[model samples]
Target: MAVDPDKAVLQELARRNPGEPFVMLNLLRFAADGRASYEEYSRRAAAFLRQYGGELLYAGDGNEALVAEEGQAWDAVLLVRYPSREAFSRMVTDPGYREISRLRSRALAEAVLQPTTPWTRRAG
Candidate 1:
């Protein structure tokens, strides 16, 4: 249940982007009574996210999964799209955002933050 990204992860994310838009998929496992704190975090984090060309595509409590393994169910799901990986990295690394990140840390027992790229047909 790693909530924070390390230097290595940031480095890899930085290396991979060519300025293309990317979406982040977040799967959250909240601790007891963690939802309120997470909501607060989200409310405050929205400004910082927007400053870096990021948008909250969706954020909602997770419902029954049509398919999943045991222990794979998440409490909430969040989808955010960023103009680029650099923008996202900068947003996370910003001092203002860092200050408010504690709320997110306190709210989740486990979480998944994955970057997704849109698919396109390849030319033959």
Candidate 2:
């Protein structure tokens, strides 16, 4: 299971929308005894998030899925909005942030970090 973004994907993410504000969807599955580590990571990462204009809109523990295939429920979910893709890229690459990122890596058994573009309303 993939837990972190690679350089290639981060580059691709920046190239796609370097200037547009976007939200990141985080689907996390914790490793054994991982939640505590992840909480610590979140605490440390808050400073970086503020430094780079990232806002955590929502975070919640997952409950039983009302509708989903087997093995589809996540352990936690987070919606984080960034000023732009570049800001997100910068945050991840920052040396300070990188130092603490290991906590996140050890905390998750698997993760999905997806960038989301808001939909525009269509004129009727």
Candidate 3:
């Protein structure tokens, strides 16, 4: 597949909105026994998010820079920034997303979603 650098840039811009209410949906897939089909799932998930207006500020498999200290502990780490909280919710529940849910579930033994609000610094 041809990689659209423009799309990636736009997505990254959207994702890097520092003051926005971003949700860090950390998916901790249960795969302690063995490795899941993370590579495939990660590719698909990136494509899926790009279809919408999502920027991937960060992506790694533990060993990469900016990743957690306890690297390799997770099969994957994805960060997507939406325009709004509702937008995030709708994206998950959307018909298009419904199909991808299976891909997500199948790739991991289990998972976790951790939503967070991006901290904003006020000008003095």
Candidate 4:
């Protein structure tokens, strides 16, 4: 049977935070062999996020990120925190962020962005 990757990720997240209003942002950046510039791209991405008052909770690279049950085929992953989903969207659509995104696109082979909004469940 084929596993629904999105479901799996969401289930894993629900197990961790059963009743919390949180958003999970997953970034997948694949780099060309021996030509990937993750270091530079990550620095710029980090800076762009910082400008919007984004708090980076965690950062993972190809090595460590590969352990995600989905496996780390990506060059990097970043976990960031924001007050709300609208806020996150605003940050991405910001004019300054658009310019930074251009540089990011050039530094990676591919990028996948996932935004997850969680529901808070009340316990009996």
Best TM-score among the predictions, by candidate number: 2
Q: Candidate 4: global Cα-lDDT?
A: 0.56
Q: Per-residue CA lDDT of candidate 2, range 62-87, in tens?
A: 99999999998999999999999999
The most accurate candidate by lDDT is: 2
In angstroms, what RMSD does candidate 3 have relative to the true structure? 10.2
Per-model clash counts, in order, read: 0, 0, 2, 1
- What tens-digit string does per-residue lDDT give for candidate 1 at 14-114? 77864878999999999899999999999999999889999999989899888999898899999999999888888889999999999999999999999
Stretches of candidate 4 exceeding 4 Å from the true structure: 1-22, 33-36, 63-72, 118-121
TM-score of each: 0.94, 0.98, 0.58, 0.57
* Candidate 4 per-residue C-alpha lDDT over 27-56 given as tens digits, one digit per residue, 9 for 90 to 100: 655545422454555567677666655677
State the lDDT at 107 in candidate 2: 99
> In model 4, what is the error at residue 89, expressed in angstroms?
2.1
Runs in model 2 with CA error above 4 Å? none
lDDT of each: 0.91, 0.97, 0.55, 0.56
The order of the candidates by TM-score, greatest first, is: 2, 1, 3, 4
Off by over 4 Å in 1: none
Alpha-carbon shift of residue 99 in model 4 (angstroms): 1.1
Q: Which of the predicted structures, 1 or 4, would earn the higher lDDT when compared with the native? A: 1
Q: Which candidate would rank higher by TM-score, 2 or 3?
A: 2
In candidate 1, the residue pairs with backbone N, CA or C atoms under 3 Å apart (3 or more residues apart, or in different chains) clash, namely: none
**Candidate 3 residue pairs in clash (backbone atoms < 3 Å):** 11-55, 30-110
How big is the positional error of residue 6 in model 2, measured in Å on the Cα after superposition?
0.6
